[model samples]
Target: MAGLFRRTMDYLYLACVVVGTTALVLISAVIPYAVFTRYVLNSAASWPEPLAILLTIVLTFIGAAAAYRLNLHMNVAYFANKLPPAGRRLLDLLVQLLMAVIALFMIIWGERLVEVTWHNTIADFPFLSVGITYLPIPIGGFCLLLFIIERIFLGLPPDPITHGSEAPSFD
Candidate 1:
């Protein structure tokens, strides 16, 4: 059962990486096109700016969750590293709990925001609901929640890129 769960999480993390990278690529591609159209073509496109903004939101929230799963999110290690082993473990657990609380808050409030804006459409893209753009908040929260649970129950997974090596890499 534990193996199955770990495998599932591995796949989930991969999916998050793929989706986040794709969103980032799309945002990069769209912005250049928007700039080209506005400056070279002398015609400002309405859809590009809003589309980029929406993709940015997706990239931030979703990519953040993916980063969290990989233990890549920024943390102040100076104070924590000063503690004894047990103390460091306690502090780590406390941080995980705090993160869980924040994820819960995001899920609740994000859903409410989505509900409230469901009827509203984007100004430039009338067919797209304003709420749809907010979906990343709740979705990212759920992903974070899963990662927190995995940490609490199964311990942090080994870093895929580093394996178990502690050696410094110049590359």
Candidate 2:
């Protein structure tokens, strides 16, 4: 059961990566078109800028959750690395607890933010609610919380180095 759950989470992590990557790819495409339209065509495209902002929101929140799962985010672990094995383990736990607090903060506040702004819509995309744009914050928070649960029960995922030759995994 645990293995199954872990494997399922692997898929969840993949989803985060996919969403983030897609947003990045889209932003790349949209920005250049905006530049081309403004310079070459002598007409500015209003939609690109706002669309890019929305994509940025997706990339930031979703990519962060994925990065958290892999321990790939910026880590100034210099002090932690010097600790003995037992001390290091304790510190890791403390770090995870702190991360949990951050996750809960995001979930609660993000949801409230979404609710408060639900009626509002983006100017560029009038049909899209502002609340929908804010969904990524809470969704990413939930994903991170689940990853924390996995770590608490199953320990940290394997180092990317060992699995680089095989599937994508944390690698």
Candidate 3:
């Protein structure tokens, strides 16, 4: 069961990385086309900018969840590092609990946001529902929540890239 859970999480992390990277690549492609069409071709393409904006939403949320799993998310530990071992452990758990709260908030509010915009169509891409574009929010939040659970229950999974060989944190 434990192995299965870990394997599932590993796959989820991989998916997040792949999807986020693809979104970023698409955004890169989209923005250049937007620029070229507007400045060089003498006509701005409306779809490119909106498409890039949508892709950016995917990149930000999914990429952040992946980063959090790998402990690559921004973390300031100045005060945490100063605590005694026991105090540090407590603080670490506190941080995790707080992260869980944040994840829940994202899920709840993100869903409401999606529902509220469900019927709205993007101006440039009328066939695409605005709510469909907002899916990454709740999806990313769920991924984050899963990763947090894994960290709390199983300890951090071995970093896929580093295999847990990161430089030791302060004792």
Q: Top lDDT: which candidate number?
A: 2
Candidate 1 to truth, TM: 0.93
Q: Give the candidates in order of TM-score, highest first.
A: 1, 2, 3
Worst 10 residues of 2 by lDDT: 162-171
lDDT of 2 by residue, 123-149 (tens): 889999999999999999999999998
Q: Candidate 3, 79: how far from true, in Å?
A: 1.6
Query: What lDDT is reached at residue 90 by model 2?
Result: 95
lDDT of 1 by residue, 1-171 (tens): 877888888888888888899999999999999999999999988899999999988988888988998789887899899999999999999999999999999899999999999999998999999899999998889988988888888999977774436767779
Q: Whole-model lDDT for model 3 versus the true structure?
A: 0.91
- Score each candidate by Cα lDDT: 0.90, 0.92, 0.91
TM-score of each: 0.93, 0.92, 0.92
The TM-score between candidate 3 and the true structure equals: 0.92
Model 2's TM-score against the true structure: 0.92
Which lDDT value does model 1 have at 112?
95
Q: Which ten residues in a row have the lowest lDDT in candidate 3?
A: 159-168
lDDT of 1 at 171: 100
Angstrom error of the Cα, residue 60, model 3: value is 0.9
